[model samples]
Target: MTRSPFTRRTVLASSAVLASSTALAACGGGGDEGGDTAEKIENPDENINPEGLPIVEEEITISFMSRRSNASAEDWNEVAAAQTTQELTNIEVDWGLVNEEAAIERRNLLLTSGDYPEVFYRTGVPSGDIAKYGEQGTFIPLNDLIEKYMPNLTARMEEYPALRTGLTFPDGNIYSLPGIYDPTSLGLRYQTKFWIRQDWLDQFGMATPETLEEYQAYLEEVAASIEGSIPLGGQDMGSILTSLYGTFGLANHGNDAGLIDLDADGKVRYFPASEEYRDLLSFLAGLYSKGLLQQDIFATDAAAFSANGTEGLLGSCGVQTPSGYFGKEGDNYVALKPLVRNAGDEPAWHAVRSELSSIGNFVMTDKSEHPIEIARWMDFWFGEEGAKLFFLGVEGESYEEVDGRDELIPELLEDKTVDEALKPYVLYLGGWYPGWATDDWFRGVETSEQSTEGSKVVEPYALKEVWPAFTFTAEESQQITTIGNDISKYAEESLAAFVTGDRSLDEWDDHVATFEQIGLADFVAAHQTAYERRS
Candidate 1:
């Protein structure tokens, strides 16, 4: 067997790697007591070509576990992209795909039953689980694997330091790969947005509101004029209220206590405890009191919200895109700029999700004998050519170059009776490969009239400052899981009560005190330590 240059030196198991010889023997200890030998299959010397496609010279079978979407081909073997990839790379993957609905349960069962695949693709492992499994020797650390066999991924990490930082565990080893993305895309550039009914504004002979006062007046006027319509509709109170909180300079996401950030003096401060947050709650309470906001703001279901939007019963909404709920009726909605509470204030700060936002897209388990081959196979997808294949599919078949820009042809997107047009290409489109979404992809490409117009309406309002999704150390992770969960639940419950007038604003101090009592200080300290360590 050929040894990989990236052979891991550390103990494959937990801190008890140096346990008694009897115990080690019981655990199938075969290598150095402290360091385990790399598990490998027969090396295909000719197949180790990193310079070209068909990464392995001969056919190599690797088993994979992934969550299957309805859009994906029922049989992973029949997926066009899977077939094409095999044809190109000679990597035959035996896929065990569970439906998305049962994926997590199935994944857990597979892991516990000792029937897990050598690799997991697409179905990301959570941070806590990654740390747990990595420590338990269930998942192999990939830092060494990346350094030796993954030039494409290494180059990307170098380009975007966040990718490496976000995926790295507190133990100073990486456990999984991330789905890298180009953040310059319009969709990647922003997350939460405010969309208003332009048709309503036109009918009422009113202009789009720019300031908080103007927005309040507009909502009031809409409520007074329209019958059976909500002035502001939202999926939840959090989504709608975050827009208000943004204007007040507290970029709060709902239910987070230690979504803490550095204040002007560079000390970690909890935004929810700040004066701005109280003001936000009060403002929302006033809106609720006036019946301008949706009555069922605290409801878990978004069916009513979507139904209202589709029926043109909503004046404005906080949504990622109007197209999601409004469909063709989305044309009537236009994005609202982040309203200023007052003139001369800096841009409003919404919680914008980063495009490099994935926990653990791919992982190799101890069952793998050909980890290097697996790394090489996945590395191809991170490269320029592979990105084209993963996202756009076969150019001439699924997409075509229109005036130098790659666009999915109408045949796959339009020719069918309705949404069935893309069924023929579903396999190609649904093929799983961990990589970046390129500018040519739909999310990146802003060619559509709606996308172009939506960008114009919302881009300028995007905040310069963002709450970075920082990776946590093991200690911090443990503390957050304990204290943070409690604080989040309290915040969510209190937010609903305060906004709905069930809890008095006078009780705000008591609520802040409660957060402190529930280990808020420890939560903030953990985040602060992580932030400074990263710096």
Candidate 2:
């Protein structure tokens, strides 16, 4: 078997000393008096199958730690997906459920106190922590385990090499498994888009905007013609601004304070200090001044945005699907093509979500007693049977196959929405999980035709080369966190000020200078180093 370059033995050998020392300290001593080490559970050769189910002959239980949704059942054993998986694999799970709000603190406490469950599932552990813990031997490296035990995932990695590259750390080891998706799939590629009121466009006899000027002109007309209409209404100001950044030929990179991206020359550039960001802010300020944008865009919540849309007061908005805000009335809205800087210029970008999540979805700790069994157990999710079970639920219960398509039961959709109806059975609806996502489940059952069409409308213009999930050294990660938190808060506040005319754009240069003084250059340099290393 061809192993991933990320699993090279040379890298592991080099770090063995550091790992051993850290492991010893974490265990409180090196001798027998120290904490228990992971033990291999002996199973009969006939009991284990590399590519099939019933992973173990006799049923075995493993401890899993993860955050649970408020709507989900309190016990994992009661959840439909868990129950089905246990039946299929004959591997029971002892779940350690954490409340969503307390997940982060609890995760940190476990890591710090050296008290770990056998596995972490859907805990949203960041890549940096994965690297830090993997190096310290708190989280065991999964490279060899993946190659040896996870044949389904190994085939997937072979088919989509990017999946392996995306999940590998700098030390050439994989510490976690990500929720995988097809990169070219339209549903994942164009997750959110700028939408316009087709009814309002017809009301004014205006065509769909093709360029920035036309887009602004349409908004201006809507402000002048419609009574009490918000030309552009959005609940999240940051996301709304991100949607427009592409028109100015900028990649909507990073979250919060780490707003760095590669330039035309592939050099890292901090966006808040860039000339393109300035132009975008200037255009937005003009929109705010002209009463075309929502008056309380910064303060508007989802409920308020939905209320405005329900009242037919929004002429345009940014959303994953208009149905979320307008219900069936969303049919009046149409997904607008990504507007270009000029009439003939190619659209540069749109909202895109990566096929792989940035955070660790599933990981095994050093204390797992049955590492091989656990690896095989986890691999089930990447195969057809497990994916179907996790995504669609039981064959007849959650969904029924109709003419080769998986469709939700009519009774589930009668009074409740698709999500509300499915929440009781599915563990994480429209959220991240530890499995491969199928386009069949997503497009056929999860989304509506309107939403799929909306994604298709913007699919051609979506950015092809968005930033990859980068892994940083522990020192680099700490520097980024320390500097990024302050920078992100400042940038958001400054953006609000500039748009609302509370802060003059004339002082934009000083704002840029403040960013520089606040270690913007260092932040970009650190990211650049990581990008170059990954390349």
- Say which candidate scores most in lDDT: 2
Give Cα distance to truth, residue 441, candidate 2, Å.
1.1
Q: Name the runs in model 1 displaced over 4 angstroms.
A: 1-46, 113-115, 252-258, 300-302, 415-420, 423-433, 443-449, 465-468
Candidate 1, residues 1-535, lDDT tens digits: the string is 2111211122112113423422332343121311321534224355567557777787889888888877766786765556777888888988788788887787766765656778877776667667766666667888887887789889988987767767777788788887655666665445456878787788788888888777888899889888988898887876676556568766532222235666667877777777778988898888889998888878845787777788878888776677766778877888777788886776655545555656566888877756778888888778876666666666687777889887777767654422244444433244333677645664322324455466556567655444435567544565566666667777787788888898888877777777776767877887787667766
Candidate 2 global TM-score: 0.90
Model 2 misplaced stretches (Cα beyond 4 Å): 1-47, 252-258, 443-446
lDDT of 2: 0.73
lDDT of every predicted structure (CA atoms): 0.68, 0.73
Residue-pair clashes per candidate:
1, 2
RMSD of each: 8.7, 7.7
lDDT of 2 at 482: 58
lDDT of 2 by residue, 1-535 (tens): 2111222233334345545644554552122211333334333245566557788878988888888766556776886878888888888888788877887788777776677687887778877677777776778778878888889889888987767777888888898887776665565556567888888788889889988889899999888998888899887785576677678766655222246676778688877788888888898998899888888998889899888888888888887777766776777899888788778987755466666644487888877777778899888878887777776677789889889988878888898876677665666563647777766775332256776788888777776655557778765765666566556767888889999888888887778877765667777888888878877
